[model samples]
Target: MTTNEPRPAMTMRQIREGLGHIEPGQPDPIVQTTGYTVSCLPEDHDERWTYTVRVSYRGDGLWSVQCRSQYVDADGKRSPGFCWSRGPQEPATQAEMDDFDAEQAEWLKAYRFDHVTALRIAKQLAPTLTYRGRTVADALAEPVA
Candidate 1:
C-alpha cells in the first residue's frame, strides 16, 4: 500500500524552464517572451526596434502581461527599454480564471496580429518586397492570410 503526498511548489526558474507541474499554491509557468520588428519599417531600416509581449506569473496568485519595446543594436543585441503592463490581478474563481485566460489570449493575439498583417502585405507586394525579410513570421508557426 502507498500513501499519496502533495508535491512541492515549483520555483520560478523551474516554472520558467518547464521542469515540473504547478500545484495550486505554485505560480504558473511563464511564457517565453518573443520580440517582433515593427511591420512598417523596411527590413534594413536603421533605428528599428523590437516589440515584445511578456506573460509572467507574479507571485501571490497574480498574473500579468506586459507590452514592451527594445532598441536593437548594430550587433543584434537588445536594450532594456520600456513597457506597459496590465494586472497583477488574482483570479479567485473558475470564471475569473477563464476570463483571465481569454484576456491573456487576446493580448498575445494582438501582439501577433501585426505579423499576420505584414505577411499579407508581403504576399501582396512580393515582387517589390523580394529582398525584404521577416523574423516574427516564424514565431506564428502557421500560415496566415
Candidate 2:
C-alpha cells in the first residue's frame, strides 16, 4: 500500500472504477480513491497533505479512503507523504504521512476481513477446496437440519 512513486490527480469516475474492480459488487469491502490536489506543493520544498473520507456501515463496519503524495524539498530531501496545499501553504514536514500510516495500520488490524470474504477469495483463487475431500461450497452447504 506504500509507494515511493508520484502520480497525477485522479478523477472521481476513475476512483470509482478502481474500487469496483477491487471489490466488484461486494457488500462490505474497503474502497480507496486515487489522490487529487486541492492545491499544489512548491517545487522547491517537500510538503504533505492528506484527506480521509470515512465510510461507515451497519454494525461496526468502518472504512476510509486515504490519499497522499511526496514532493522534493529545497534541501534535496524527498518528503514522503501527500503534498497538497491548503490556504496556499504546504506542511513543513512528513509527520502527517507517518501518522496516517500508523493510523491506517491500526484501523486495518481492527477491521480485518470477514469469513465470507476469506471464503470467497479462496474459492476464486482455486477451483475446489480440498480441506476434507470436498469443495468449499460443498462443505458449507452440507445439511445441518
Q: Which candidate's lDDT is highest?
A: 1
RMSD of each: 15.2, 24.1
| Model 1 lDDT tens row, 33-115 | 34322233345534122323333433333233332432222223333332223344344455654654555644433322243
Give the CA lDDT, 0 to 100, for residue 29 in model 2: 55
Q: How far is candidate 1 from the true structure (C-alpha RMSD, Å)?
A: 15.2
Count of backbone collisions in candidate 1: 0
Best-performing candidate as measured by TM-score: 1
Off by over 4 Å in 1: 1-3, 8-12, 15-113, 128-145
Off by over 4 Å in 2: 1-111, 128-145
lDDT of 2 by residue, 51-125 (tens): 111122212232212122323222223234332323323233457325445545443444323434423332333
Worst 10-residue lDDT window for candidate 2 reads: 49-58
